[model samples]
Target: MTFPQNEVRFEQLSTASPSVIYSIEEYPGRPARFDYLSPAFEEIYEIPVAKAMENAAIAFDTFHPDDLSGYQQAVIRSAKTMQPLQHEWRIITPSGKIKWVQANSRPERRQEGVLVWHGVMLDITDRKQTEAALRESEATKKQILKAIPDLIFWMSADGICLDSMPSNDAFQLFPDSGRVGKNLYTVLPPDLAEMRRQAVEKALQTGDVQVYEQRIMLHGGFYYEEVRVVGVGDDRVLVIVRNITSRKQAEIALQESEERFRSAFQDAPIGMALIGLDDRWLKVNPVLCNMFEYSEAELLTTRMFTMVHPEDRSILQQYIEQYLGQSQTKDKKATQVELRYQCKGGQIIWVRLNLSVVRDAQRHPSYYVAQIQDITQEHAVNRMKDEFISIVSHELRTPLTAIQGFLGLLNTGIYTNNPEKTQRMLKLAMDNGDRLVRLVNDILDLERLSSGKVQLAMTTCNASELMQQAVDSIHSIADQAAVTLAVVPTKAQVWAASDSIIQTLTNLLSNAIKFSPPQTTVTLSVQTQTDSVLFQVRDRGRGIPADKLESIFGRFQQVDVSDSRQKGGTGLGLAICQSIVQQHGGNIWVESTLGEGSTFYFTLPTPDP
Candidate 1:
């Protein structure tokens, strides 16, 4: 076909355009034909323009099968109404590739009853793919927000709520009507609003996330929340709030329990300690520090085994090993042992140790807890009890054997023929019986005083008179021993039981006289003091050994074991004296030199003025 000069120029311009520029004509009872087609049409559909112009059906065949019916309907409507057509539809290329295209055109009627349309068609495949990807991304974001339980908000920089995605109505702070345009100051408490304002300002300024915690009351209950804010753009922020009430309550409960345990550990009466796995002292209570005579700082820096007595450390170590080797089950019992501990001052003391283990989640040993009770006094008492039983048994058997043998012989008439022999034998047996009686009496008296069963009748007495009476009572014994008794009298008054004081003085005098040499003097004197009267009995006799001074006051204890048998002493006189003096709130002690003498001293509280 030949075109006019202007038409040729228009066709040349259309050849270089990206979009296909075309014109088509339609006649009644006739098919449509392209009056003009740009070179882009051939490039877009991979078909020759000459072929498409010869049969417009060549172009119509490129319409995707699914879009053909809709495309035809849109064209028919636009033709009847002579309206502009603006539509997008899918088309397939001659190469079997599917693509999207947009058509924008206007229809006009010509005088010969022919309809004509002029427009541009664009291949919008890339643009359609981009739009599809955007839609998919938006759908994915909605699904993710739906799955989370946190409350999310897009807020403006001025603390206005622009939009919100609440996981549920329970977490929504405001009604639907109150949201969107509401300010935080109206929706939240004043203090909470201020806190959020500060966080918002900080997030916008630094472009960093601001995180904080808030406790809110909602629906007549308390809720703890963790809020995080981050700048989404220059004028807006994304806020996320998570409810953490359960976790926070658990933490608070754990902290309170730890505080209670600390108080109990510190206030316990028995010694207690927490030891680390390395055998070092992690914590020590006040009682433990006092028991070991070490400060808390000293104990913490030292290993636990260092304070244990050398002979007992191995035993403690073995016990710990055995305990750790066993599985820690819920029904397992704590391990206990009695061992000795060496004090900081080098004194050894017995302790009953109760040990328990603490474990980690994996049931591995983490640390140890120890409870220690001082048992030193208990051990000493037990030892004394055993010794007392043995001594009493031997003492009673001796005199009973002699009395029984002599009586048996007399009853058998073995001495009936000798009157003088019988009399002597009878005297010996009677003497043994008297000794047995004296032993029994002394035991009963000592027991009564030791057990607090004997309550002394206290009275204000003259110290000089008590001394005189004690000396006089023991004067016959001193005479038999040929030991002189002298008294340095004092006019001091003592608040004491008269009979007990006299007996105490008598026992001291008698002991002195027995150990004194012939012609040696035994002096009894009293010295008055501010709050007490000091009584002294001095003798020139074989002195007590220094080591035996303290033990001599115990029942059945004596410096010379044979003294009880040879001197006719019951070995309980000094013990009785000690008990009596103690009951009167007095103290008794002895000072002795090896060969010179021994002086026994006792102090009794003076009578109240």
Candidate 2:
């Protein structure tokens, strides 16, 4: 084909352009053919321009299969509208390389109802790849912001909220929708806003991250937040806020628990101490110091084993070793033992020591905790109980044995042959039976009074009448002992249980008469006092020892143990008397001297005259 001079100039100008310049003619009901192609067409589509011109379908074949349909439709629409066409599509070159291209063309209609397009096609694969990479980077940034629990903000240096990433409502101090385009002063409290403003200024000036913490009250709950402000250039800053409420609460709870433990350890009533593995006292409470008669400073300076009784130190050491060994295999149990401790004053005391090991995070024994309780008084009481049991057994057996023997003799024919002997035996049996009954009754009476189980009935009783009644009751016993009974009574009246007071007097008189020698005078007297009436029983006989005066009032206690058998005494009369006097809100005591007379005195509350 030959071109005109103007057409040749147009072709020459298009050849220098880095684009494929082409022309296509479409006839009605026929395939389209290329009228021209630039030299760049061979470089872009890997097809010769001569081949493309002869058959435009040769260039169309390079269109990617997926895009060819849309390309043809665009052409048809452009031709019908006679408008400029702008389209972008993918193409596969003859060399099997895929590329992106953009086409711009103008369409015209001829007189024969034919259509033609003059267009430029440019390779845009690099630009397409760059745009795709940018889109992927934007998507990844969004995902990262979504996963973070912190509320992030892009703000101007003046504390204005420029933009914010989406975050949980709990982290947002205010609704996210209204946060942008607002100043921090409007979004937060005055104090918090001031704090953030200062931090923002500091971060921008120093170009370093500024960190702080704040407590916020929202929805009637306290929230703790850790804030970080960092300058992001251009007079802007990035603010990160993280909720730290749970962590702050845990730390506060731990501190409170530690304080409570320390208070409890220091103020415990019983002795408490902390011991190191070497048996040294790491900490000692006031009670432990008082118990050992040592100061807290002194105790801490000394080892625990040194204060332990020599005999018990080895045992405590062994227990510690065993506990540590067991902890290595499994959970260890606390151990308790009763041991003796030597006080600072050289006094020995009994204590119940409870010991347990404290373990570290790795479950290794760290130290020990000890609780000590004084049990010295308990030991003394137990010893007294044992002695009382033995004395009572012997006292009961003596009377029961005599009664049994006397009754046996009377029942047997050996005593029946003599009526006088049988009657004597019968009398002996009756007397022994009476003694036994008195012993049991005295025991019951003392027990009831001591335990506060018996309530005494109080009444006004004349002192002289009480003395006469007691003397009359014990007159026969006094006569048998060859002791003279004397009464120097007064008209004093006492507020007491009449029956119980009379019993008390009778017991005192009986005891005096029993201890008196032949022809000794036993005096019973009463004296009036300011608030009480004092009664006295005096005897001139073998007096009670000086040491026994106080102890003689105890149950089963006498100046001599043999008194229970030889003196026909149950050893409980004085104890019962003391209980009765005490129940009447009075006191009882004995004044005596060895080898001299003895006097027993007791008082009863006096009734108004």
Candidate 3:
């Protein structure tokens, strides 16, 4: 509504209000004059109505010179458009008192084609002073933020770059050519631009601060940035970019180092572990956990001592204490030692555990960096090699003994004088030749298995009959040991190469007979399980120790190394059995109790129904 009309209406009210009312007329390029002066002006401005009506410009002439030209232009433009003129100006009276003045005026076109302004002017000095002070404070605050070394920027409600301070490093890092006055989409790297735009838009819509990390392509090279976006005045946004390249490089170096460790951990043909400061495992790779038959998580949660074989724990504990104590000492640095750890299934594994210390900034011990390697396989092979040397020595003696016995007979010349004695010597010589042939065959079989050169003539046959045939073949050996041999037959048939199964069963039966006590029964049982047929050979002789049960089927492995050849057999028999069973998608295992007896079991797949 027009202020003049409103003031006229306000005066017509029967009930008087406390509001002060006045109207004025303004001319373009001329002074603005009060056309109507109300008595309320005297109280509002502390000036008489006649004094204000006489000259409106007298109150405004004391305004700051900087505002005079702008105010004059505003009135002129308003008169031309017949629009309203609204402005706030400062005034200083003759008494040297400064005050704020606010004026609102609308122009009217007269019939004479001249435009005249009619409006109202109120003394808004108090409100104007407060607003001026606020603007000054805001200018000072922006100067402070701009002075910081970091890049600070602001985006508009639509994601366009509205204002920025310091430099355009933020835009230079992006793949886009130029970013000034452009939207985030136009300035972002092609791959990540869309993502960044979406994230910023989402934050704007939700009015929430968003934080993220990204690799930005800059003129120099790629850089990692930690970015944060916060909502500010009038739907604007403040974004900050922090350079975290050094921290990222450190993490990458650590990751690469960890990968190197993993390669050593998995492919080292040994088990490894990462232990914590308190002797607990913090990390364990596949091989390490696999050696102990424990899951990685399960191993990590348990203490290292819990897995140590009890017999070696005290000795191992001392080494562990010494290593850790040395690593913790300021002068000692890191330490490495070889120790024994028990598997989850009560197997002792010899491991060479190498340990180092990871320290924090405070130089305090943080964690134990450990590398555990299981050397059981190596140890087993070494022991077998020693046994093999002994077996070779015994084998060498067999021929020498025969030669020595014949020479002794010749020394008496009794074999030459007596035809029967000479014939007995010839027979003994032939028996020794046969024994040498068997020894050579055993060695050749082991070579073939190790080189993966053993090929099977596969044929499906009845599993029970194969067991019976092997039992019959070993019957003579059982009789020599004075051990009764029994075969428990099964009705189930299997699909496998008959000859291989026969050979596997023969080895098991012969071992049972050789190890059995005189006149004790050696039982051979065949039964059918869900997917495979089971064959077992149990003897009444002294059983194998639990520690050696798994390795019994390995090449050149023997329960009693000293008597292995004396028992009239080669150690490769069980190894061949294992190879045959594995070739047919089956397995062989042993259950033994020390000083009792052993049961050797093998499985063959049942024929398809």
lDDT (CA) for every model shown? Answer: 0.89, 0.87, 0.74
Ranking the candidates on lDDT from highest down gives 1, 2, 3
Per residue, candidate 3 scores C-alpha lDDT tens digits across 489-587 of 667788888877887888888888877779889888878899988888888779998889998887557877655647766667888888878887888
Choose 1 or 2, whichever is better by TM-score.
2
Superior candidate under lDDT, 1 versus 3? 1
For each of the candidates, the C-alpha root-mean-square deviation to the true structure, in angstroms, is 6.5, 5.6, 15.7
Instruction: Please rank every candidate by TM-score, starting with the best.
Output: 2, 1, 3
Distance from true position, residue 218, model 1, in Å?
5.7
Clashes of 2: 0
TM-score of each: 0.69, 0.76, 0.40
lDDT (Cα, tens digit) per residue for candidate 2, span 118-196: 8999999999999999999999988898788888888998889999887676656655788899999998999999999
Highest TM-score, which number? 2
10 residues in a row with least lDDT, candidate 1? 167-176
Which candidate ranks first by lDDT, i.e. highest?
1
Point out the worst 10-residue segment of candidate 2 by lDDT.
166-175
